[model samples]
Target: MKRRKFLKNSSLSTAGIFSASLLASCETDKKPQVVNKMIKPIVIATWDVLNATNKAWQVLNNAGTALDAVEQGVMIEEADINNQSVGKGGRPDRDGNVTLDACIMDKDSNCGAVLYLKNIVHPISVARKVMEETPHVMLAGKGAELFAYQKGFKKENLLTEKSKAEWLEWKKTSKYQPVINIENHDTIGMLAIDSKGDIAGACTTSGMAYKIGGRVGDSPIIGAGLFVDNEVGGATATGVGEEVVRTVGSFLIVELMRQGKTPQEACEEGVKRIISKNNEKLDFQIGFIAINKKGETGGYCIQPGFTYRVYSEQGHINKTASSYISS
Candidate 1:
């Protein structure tokens, strides 16, 4: 009986070993999971920028670098005399000066910015020159304007009759009201991943309509207005600059993506970070747009009328982002 018992135990042990070996073989044969496979050649931007996305897609489709694509794309908007929120048509500050702010970032982490730069119809291009030709990362006011002129950037009268007329009307009350969803202060912050899967970004704005003179928003501040990490992703912001600057919103989104959050999740969290510190009602608007290395994109805002544009092989579309307050 004892021998029979030992034989039974040995048979059970043999069966267990066979099962273990079979399981190991099956596991070894299984395919490794791939997360968020890379989708090359995509572009995203804040607000209704169909033309800008099309311009960017034109470059990416032609095998241009991400830096060149983003820089060129926003230039279209920057040059648009009808775009009152940026560049040529941007509304003036309280002092009736058309000060533009812009920044650019390349895949290699090189960045450049210009603030309170007046008479430049394409501050985005000037910012690019700063990134490419100068030793400094930022130049402001008269210095920035002089650098732009030195780089052969022609000074132009950016304020248009339409914007100037509005400024005159605004001076009537001189009220310091910042209207959410107005689109008057809409900034064009753009991101692109080229066919090579490298990422770059640009943000350009006339700044908030009727903002105090000499006030610099997040639009031209690296890490606050825009951030790019070739191994991770890139992010850009629009809306009120102070709130975005306070939270380091664009950088926060990229870091969140590095920690494995989806682009949409990262954008949502960035907006929430602002809400978390609030002691009063949210009467202002703030928006963020992000794209991961995988070419997946996402956006979120504090208020409605926040939309982002996308152009890829999948086609161009303007998507309204989910807002924190509406939720």
Candidate 2:
């Protein structure tokens, strides 16, 4: 009987030891699997995208929101010296006049835009204000400038010596008829999602080089050239001013996402819609990029070499330059 009691006690002791070991193993595994509840840093960027990557890193590291980073980054592109086709020194259209416009949107709040504005150096800032302060979604032309002026925005000489020289040369070539038809003007657009997973976008341009005074392209059209929806992500486009204006490419991309397409597929569908139309002979190339909530991103251009930049949570910011050298 004593022997039996000893065997039972030993067995119980062994089982208890095994149970403790199992519990210790579970505790060890649980430490690593704590659901990674740590907050991620913010992310932001603009399409200027080359060294702008560092700027995005700076903003994210500092805890700036994704929208703040994107707008700031695009502002950098607008202010770039050699960007020639966007803001300040942009190429003119057939006319010698210069106009400017910009737009920005945040998917987080479902509120944002600036449209058909002129003489305003920083349309995106105005757009953010309109979204945040005023009840309206868009402000345009003189009214836009008036609002900007009232808000203490200082206007500068939008026309630069280089742009003027180009205008004069074209005028000389056309005997100042103001009917020189040159194509291939470009613009700037940026779309981004930060580590925090919020989305934002901006588009800016000096009006089509020599476009008629007060002419506005898709650049300032909210859904036309730029759009952001946190549920899906965001998108922005540039190139072929008129075609982009007419097709509403940016909103179309979001709608494509609504229809269950990937960001790249949505971009392709938007481009296809522009191409398959039998009605219009589009003069310039249009290019766009999109990022969905899943972090799947895609871009397309109707022109052969169309490309844009991208910055996201998983990848560092980089420019993917492209154009439509062909059809």
Candidate 3:
């Protein structure tokens, strides 16, 4: 009888221990799960266009969408009468016409563009409307103007008195030489990542000074002047748009990021591609700026004097030089 009682007690204790262990395991599993915290917003642009960057930062600061932030940011530059490479006071073409080109892209791969568009003060806004309202990816010339007018955008002369005077001066010389960043800044390419981590980009320009009428450069082309892939990153180009178009530079940088390269590495690769393809060496400069999904930024250029502006939580506004400048 004593031996049987001891065996029964041991079995009960064993059962109780196993039940306690199971209960503890269940409680642990029921604990709340943790989610990843969102990173702060970032704004980056091709030039030290701090005014535009600050405008973009306001959108991001207010928790606005990335697409809206990029559009609003570049629009500031587009409206600045002092800025000769973009917006209202931009340089005229060889025919004394103020034609504009612009493109916008979102994380969902939706993009829109307008090329050779005339008499529109804000081409970036028109590009956004095209992306949101139309099925087609691009509209050009009078068609773009019609669309802009239909969409309630005012039709006004884009050329300013200062621009006209400069055009007259150029006519006297008839020289086509373009000094980088002075006469040939080409475009303002802006990229932004909102608080929600969504990415978008915009590129707007009056194209090359003295370019032939109806000339469209990389600024209006999605993969060339601007590209955005939310999962990977975004990139934009400036300087010589033709060189950028030939290499599909912005798209190449995004792909490089997807392939695990850093933003700097990707931008450098874009510059190298341009160099390799133009074996005869380019007479003009070409530059690329990129921002990764993590909000890290980088830039590279074929010639010296290329710079970019970056804004992030860690830094307010940083003016950084490109990685490479040809000798």
In candidate 1 the C-alpha lDDT for residue 241 amounts to: 91
TM-score of 2: 0.76
lDDT of each residue in 216-305, candidate 1, tens digit only = 899999999999999999999998898999999999999999999999999999999988877535878889999999989999998888
lDDT of each: 0.91, 0.67, 0.87
Top lDDT hit: 1
Per-residue lDDT over 32-61 for candidate 2, one digit per residue giving the tens place of the 0 to 100 score: 533223334333232445554456556666
Per-model C-alpha RMSD = 10.2, 12.9, 10.6
Candidates ranked by lDDT: 1, 3, 2
Give the alpha carbon lDDT tens digit for every residue of 169-261 in model 3.
888887664433334764899999988888999999998887777778899899999999988899999988878899899999999999999
User: Model 1, poorest ten-residue lDDT window?
Assistant: 176-185
Q: Which stretches in model 2 have alpha-carbon errors above 4 Å?
A: 1-48, 51-53, 92-97, 175-184, 279-283, 313-327
lDDT for predicted candidate 3 compared with the true structure: 0.87
Instruction: Judge candidate 1 against the unseen true structure and give its global Cα lDDT, from 0 to 1.
Output: 0.91
lDDT of 3 at 125: 91
